[model samples]
Target: MSTFFSDWYYLSIRSIKQIWRPLLALIPSLFIPIFFFVVNSSSLDAFSKVPGFPPSITYRDFIAPTALFTAVFFSSGNAGIELVQDISNGYFKKLLIMPISRLTIILGRLTEVAVQAVMQGTIVVVLLLLVGVRIQTGVLGLLAIFAMLMIFAMAWSCVSMISALRTQNARLVQSLFVVVFPFLYLTTSQAPMPLLPPTFRLIASYNPVTYIIEGVRALVLTGWGNPAIWQGFLVATTLFVIMVTLTLGSFKKALR
Candidate 1:
């Protein structure tokens, strides 16, 4: 049991260090969403005056959570990219042969992803604050939002983890980057669900990403009393469980 944790610690540190070494790898994922946030919020600040939009909030406040969502969600696949590198360079097989639990290896990468979420999420939050966005729930809600985002980051990264394990093809795994577009745009990134066109409204209603966005967005625009936050927690938790299970299965298969 202690050994599992010990393995997780070292492996996680290694993964985190690699991200910071180049640093450039993390920049695009972090900044692109900020640029999007700046442009959209500036252009759509007038949209807040429209009917059916939530009251007492500007467009910047409403879309702040969505920007955070995009930043973290878009970066989730990076762990898989690292895993692919380990495979290509023969380091992964070395770890496989070591005297350690296989599950620990996977857990280590997930931990790294969680740390990445923290770093990226914090940057987004600080940027939001600088832009005059405030969290309605105060410090507690702010912390809770970070917790939920980490779960979300880990859950989404399992896609890349599974891809790296199953295909071992870097290009194929990189191609999965396209998946972020549908999940991001299909949600309430631009406008509230009620304000969306009928087709977009129906689709956003079904996308779990919508709840996750609303959940975090509520922390900024509303408060803890809003049920959207809990729904986000639920959906993100469910996704983490399902994706981690599948990832473990893939890990076991790769060992075979």
Candidate 2:
């Protein structure tokens, strides 16, 4: 058990060091969400006062989760790109021959992603607080919010890892954001579900990002009483399990 944890720790540290530059590159990922939050809140501030809108919650509070989610979604792709680089440069091949468990290698990379997610989420939360967004659930809710972001990041990273392992192509892995961006808009990012156009509301209902955004919003705007919080957690966990299984399968195939 000690050996397993030791390997996991070392590999995670090494991956963090190797990917520091790419992590630095993700600064823009963090900024874009903040910028979106600012512009979106500024434009929609008055909408918060609408009769159906949740009482006392500003547009900033309502949209803060989306901004955090955007940062997490974009940042999660970096691990896969880094993995693809390792494959292209023959580093992955060397690791395959080592006595280390294959799962640890992937977990190590994912740990780095989780760390990045926490940092990115923290920055977003801090910025949101600075701009007058307060969490109704208080500090505990803030912690839960961060935990959800990390889980979301890990799940999304697994998807990217699956792509990297299967294609060994950095370009393909990088293009994932293009695929993810549409989901962002299709969900309840910009406004409440009822406020959305009928067509958009229908689509957002089926979108997992909708649940995630709603869940996080519950923590910020409502509290644990909101059913959306548990639903979002379930969706995120389902995504994590499915993607991690696929990623492990892809990693196994790469070994063959």
Candidate 3:
């Protein structure tokens, strides 16, 4: 088991080296969301006054978690694009020809991607604080926030890798956000579920992102616990299982 872990660790380092440059290419991705946060943070007062939401929380605090999560989501999803690129370049084939366990190859790549996800989340957190978003949960609350983001990042990275494994297409990996971003926006990004349009309210209730927003809000704000934390946890767990299963199966078939 130790040997297995060591091999996976080394392979993860290898993947990091291979993918670092392309990952750096994504520095430009933060600008748009930061711009959104600025524009929306300023408009949040009017929006909160627009109705239905509890009056105590500022719109900046309300929408901050979604922006943080978006950073993780995009970073994790894009981190896996190199997996498809490596496969196309026959790097995966070379790894397969080596004596290492196949699972290690996947796990190593995933570990590297997951680390990147946490970095992505941290960057957003820093940005949020820079723009005056505060987490009143103190030390414990801050820990919880980071823990949740990292767990979500791990789960999300696996899903991204699964997408790459299934299609082996960089375009498909890139396009995953097209589907995810719209859902995220339509959900609780702007307000609580009650303030959303009735159609969007129903959809947001079902959205996994809703749970994340709720969980984060519950931690950051003083008294806004939505029972949806369990739902987010469940969705993250389910996606992890489904993604890892499919990715391993695809890896197996690719080797065969």
Candidate 4:
């Protein structure tokens, strides 16, 4: 047990060092969402309070999860860059040649990325709180938001790493964000799916991101419960399994 943990610890530290640049690149990522929170939120609050909708919802509460999801979406998608670098620079090859367990290398890299995602999510949440986004569930609710983001990050990171290994094309992986973000925002994050048009509602209903947003929204918005929260988690777990299996298979192939 100790040996296994020791291996994980070593690989985890190495991953943190290796991906320091990408992690540090989160500066703009940290603030851009806050900018949106300030701007659109001001407009949204005023408009939502009109006679029909009375969008009394605060700007901070409404947009906070979206920012958190954006962080997860972009971070997970871009995680491939680190893997691409590792492969191109031959660091991945050297790691593979070591006596370490293959799974440890993969999990350690994933753990490191997950840690980074949680940190980014926490910062965004704090920013939201500072801006007066009240969490009805208090600290526990806040933790739930972080937990959901972490799960999404973990599952998506697995897929991102697999894509990194298979394609080894940083551009292709980077393009994933453009695809993912639109799908994510089109869901319940920006607005409730029920209010969307028929086709969009259908799409949002089945969208995994919708589930994630709903899960976070449930905790954030209060009284917004849905069974799909659990469903979203199941879907994420299934995706994690498929991605990890593919990644491990590919790792063996690459080593051969």
Lowest lDDT 10-mer window, candidate 4? 46-55
How high is the CA lDDT of each candidate model? 0.87, 0.84, 0.72, 0.72
**Residues 48-161 of candidate 2: C-alpha lDDT, one tens digit per residue:** 988877776777778888888887777687888899989999999998898888888888998988888887788887787787778889999888887777787888888888
Which candidate tops lDDT? 1
TM-score for each prediction? 0.96, 0.93, 0.87, 0.87
- In model 1, pairs of residues that clash are none
Per-residue lDDT over 150-221 for candidate 4, one digit per residue giving the tens place of the 0 to 100 score: 777777777767777878888876667666766776697766555677988888887777888777766776
Per-residue lDDT of model 3, residues 1-256, tens digit only: 8988999989889877754676556675565567777788886667766667778778888778777777666666655687888789998789889888877877787676667666666778888888788887766776676666666666677766777777788888888877767767777877887777789888888877777767777777752354555556566667667766677777755555
lDDT of 1: 0.87
Q: What is the RMSD, in Å, between candidate 1 and the native fold over all Cα?
A: 1.3
Model 1, residue 37: what's the lDDT? 94
lDDT of 2: 0.84
- RMSD vs true structure, all candidates: 1.3, 1.7, 2.4, 2.7
Worst lDDT window (10 residues) for model 3?
Answer: 222-231
